[model samples]
Target chain A: MKKLIAVLTVLLIASALVFAGGNGESSGSGKKVVKIGVYEPASGDNGAGGKQETLGIQYANAITPTVTINGTEYEVQLVIVDNESSNDKAVTAASELVSKGVSLVLGSYGSGVSIAAADTFASAEVPAIGVTCTNPQVTLGNDWYYRICFLDPFQGTVLANYAKDTFGAKKAYALAKLGDDYSVGLCNYFIKAFEALGGQVIYETFPEGTSDFAAYVTNAKNGGCDVFYSPVSIEAAALIIEQANTQGLPMPILAGDTWDSNVVLAAAKGTNVSISVTTFFVEGSTDKQITDFVDGFKGYLASNATALTNNGGNDEIAAVTAMGFDAYYVALEALKKAGSTKGADIQKILPGVTYKGVSGDIAFDKNGDAVRNVAYVKKVDNATGKWQFVSVQSVK
Target chain B: MGFLQTNLPYLLAGISTGGQYALIAIGYTMVYGILRLINFAHGDVFMCAALMVIYSASYMPLYISLPLAIVATGVLGFAIERVAYKPLRTAPRMSAMISAIGMSYLIQNLALYVTGGLTKYYPPVPFISDSIEIFGAMTKRVTIITPFVTLVLIVVLVNIIKYTKIGIAMRAVSRDFETAQLMGVKINSVISATFVIGSLLAAIGSTLFFSNYTGVTPTVGGMPGLKAFVAAVFGGIGSIPGAVIGAFIIGICENIIKGLGWTTFSDAFTFVLLIVVLMFMPTGLFGEKATDKV
Candidate 1:
């Protein structure tokens, strides 16, 4: 009986090995495998945002399955890892991607994590294409890190200008989350630009892990500010929206790219406040290319309900997802232009490569940042229970 | 008058938040008193209660779900004590403490796994979350009710400890474990009762807490747990009244500091206050001086 049991165990182990081997060979039997690594936060503070970004990349991969390189077809496989939305975990996640031998990488929705993982990618010589991490330091001195979206400075200024032009605001309240690199950075830029536009600004901050915003909203109301600008994460934004509405602090609420979330939209439904944000993409564009992409993406989401949950349980397309979609196509274009799937080869070909992506016409400037001027302004139409496209503002 | 007008809202917020801290802190104190072991899992029990509401509120009606979730949380606390703490009772005190910590990690990671590290939206209870204007400060109804609820629970709990048979058994077990066993006290049942009461309070606390926040995350219990634990320590670790007072003091101080525009220093100020209290009083405001016989 013991011998028979041992024989069965051996047979099971051998079959498992055979199945694993069979799975590996079927993907690249006659084609070269080109890997694009996704380092995202599947858990942690920024997990929701990171999951949405991953969905966009996965959708793009589904649409464009293969890229031809040097008269040979290469299967594009995505190697994904969860960074847990932490700086320390980002280093480990980035190193894991490096070990996977991915030709290029697209990732990281949060700026702090992206900046944390930048050195790993730079040292490994693997060019990383950032989707929606808007902190300026991400691409400032790092040659290997390229972003497909505008930086916080531009986004902050656009928001400040929009407040001035649309609302005719003379006073603004700048609220941020303390110790957050993205919130503090964007808040400072907004203050500077608002002050430059001759608007009085009162700056305030709340500590991390704070679930309360009543005091801050009350402070803003009593301070006599016409506009409330809080560039915070989505979870915090949800609470702020609810409180601000209940408090009846009737001011135009403005934010940077992080506010472009369906979670925030869902929270803002039935609220009295007008929520607007400057972001990388808007779905209801008249541009045919964008319209086609949005339609196809909706169809993709229609079949995949789980994907919709990852995008905050709504059908609305997020700006970060659109940016993720564009970042994937951009990496593919660079890979095909290089005609070789080496890090250095793709990095060389990436400088001049441009693709009119689903989000926008993506072209890199001298600093490996997207040289785009237009920012989409979207507002939550509480009446319609949807995020409505307002207008596009250009940084002149 | 200007100062009073400006600071009234902050004071109310502090009181509401303080009540939450006290509710959670009482759990820490009571369990510590009975077990002579710092039950680190108490905070995670609070987190589980909040998550239970978020999940159950989706399918069940609010009225049924609220009571059902609280009872489930109480049962979870009871089970945790039985499985994790009860086995380590005969072993060294350190073993039970470590088990408590282990149970904490287990619950947190399980929450993380089940929720997929996503923040689940707390289904808004109609009247509990509605905002009402008081003294020109607009705040939720939960904020006003938290302190009164906490006070009523404390009075009822204190009376039980002073009078009831199970409560008297609990006191005896906390006073002397071996002697209580010799005197025919059901030591195991007493410990389980302690957990049940602690878990009930935590469930109630979590309902009020999540009502204000309106969103639940896996690590939601972590900060509040740490703060409540700090309140427990500051109030003299095993004393109930001390824990409640310590929580209120910390809550008020942090909010006032934040309202003063030093938002960055508010959290730091909490630790600083803890350190100062430790240095000065040593045993806390209402803590009894214990004499150890070697």
Candidate 2:
């Protein structure tokens, strides 16, 4: 029971934060304390993402104890709101963060979640940078919204191009989540790009979350497509991959950024499992910024260590934390260049400013997308238990 | 022939799932027949059984996990009866119903909290899943074993309920709890035993289900439990045999619909079938009225 409880504790820290979300009277904290809110799924479905985001925020705050804004140093205090990794909850967290009068908000770690929070940020005019949530809808409509990761269109193209150029895949099968707009959207984009690149998708099937995917895996295996592309929800991605491997189907399993998680990789590890994901950042890069993040995060956890015995040597590539470091870095850079901590001043220059961050050089386009097109394609190293970024595929 | 043979294994696998649904439904039917209340929390109990199975089985073979889960669930059922239902014996019907609903939510979310909401993989018994040809169809060993096991369990369960002393007490309680108590039968033990038996069957059913699916989720019991409740009601709720029949019909129909590529409406088909049966036979397929001898 305790082993189960320990695993659950690691997962449910955010849902506990969610209790904090609904209960606390709006502190209406003044701008003196640099409050940044994170909305992540803490308990259900996407709890891992939510928990990882907390780590990111804590690490970033440790490295930069106080954010210098317009020459005044404001100590960072992150107020987290658990979105339960749900779309509706993400919106609620965003509105709650605004109501609390935080200068900035970070998180809600998937594309669907970002879309849910988009309208609230648009109305409030707050700057946010998501970690691994790569949907285009997050940054497109809101002037105040931006992400540290690349968008779906580019990611879909990356997969499409990889299938074409690398595998020489003339025919592929698309297995996606039926009711999920995120899976369907990415699958559609990938199919469109693949066909345009002189490839063919012979068949496509949509499965519900409860649908046992073994049957569908068999169908794709029998379909004899050069590849099987399942743009799945983060929640269901690992299960689908596991079943695929168990069925002994040999098709290369390619998926979206939702595949970025330690549990997903660990489950997929050492099974000769090959999955391609366009991620925000890949580990093992010799970049100084990457090294600093690795060292700084390890230090933060070591200084606050309690449960080293629990993780069984699980490395920290938790999305929310890495994205948090980048988000704080982005915000800090904006403040440095603006020479003022005023929200209005920082918001104005955010679109054009460029800074080298953990993922890569960060430059927001007019639509608030990163101006650069660097997408890290990584496969899990079953031996090393680390994600090694293969060729850095640039789509621009 | 290749297409038929290729798909036969999957189709047979579907039957394995159907078998568990039927077993769990027997409990629902037996409970429903004696007590008109549908135990919504039965699914949550199944979810609880799954957590126990995962934890207890990690240190031993899965063959050991099945009995451990069943016994644990039975104990849980006894506890549930004492804590959640016994006090509400004289409460309003609405109150009991509300309590059951609340219990269902509590158990499920607690599981979501306890299990970290991640799916746990339980691989099959080694070398047990090799396929064999039958009627020009290739099927896994599980597909061959599940139906026979389900039938044997059903027979054994039915025989005990019909012939045993406790079975007589259960039958007497179902007819009239006060009268049975007047007859010096221990009413509390009978009710607790009934619930214990029901939970035990569900644990067994869900274990078979996980064997085929290779995992159990917090929500795994939700749909299966609902269908079992429906099965119980369909088979003349209180009648143990009726629930088994109801289970088969629902299980076979669901798989056939999925097999036909009309999965979008598979759930609708079961509900429609249940509705049609309830409209004409409100008392269910095998229900009998209790006649008073004054």
Number of the predicted model whose TM-score against the real structure is largest: 1
Q: Distance (Å) between predicted and true CA of B47, model 2?
A: 1.3
Which candidate leads the pack in lDDT? 1
List, residue by residue over B1-294, the lDDT tens digit for candidate 2: 777755764566566666777778876666654555677789878778877888877788877876877899999978887887778878876777788888888888878767665555554554444445576653456666877888998898878888999988888888887788899998788878888988898887766666556555677678788877777777777877778777777777766665565555667777787898789886678866435442
- C-alpha TM-scores of all predictions: 0.94, 0.86
Model 2 chain B poorest ten-residue lDDT run? B122-131
Clashes of each: 0, 8
DockQ scores of the candidates: 0.60, 0.26
Candidate 2, A342-393: lDDT as tens digits: 4566678777777787767778777877765766677777676567777777
Q: Which portions of model 2 miss their true places by more than 4 Å? A: A1-32, A202-211, A270-273, A298-313, A316-321, A335-346, A381-388, B57-66, B120-144, B214-217, B233-236, B266-269, B272-294
Residue pairs in candidate 1 whose N, alpha carbon or C atoms collide under 3 angstroms = none
Candidate 2 chain A lowest-lDDT run of ten: A305-314
Off by over 4 Å in 1: A1-30, B1-5
> Model 1: what TM-score for its first chain?
0.91
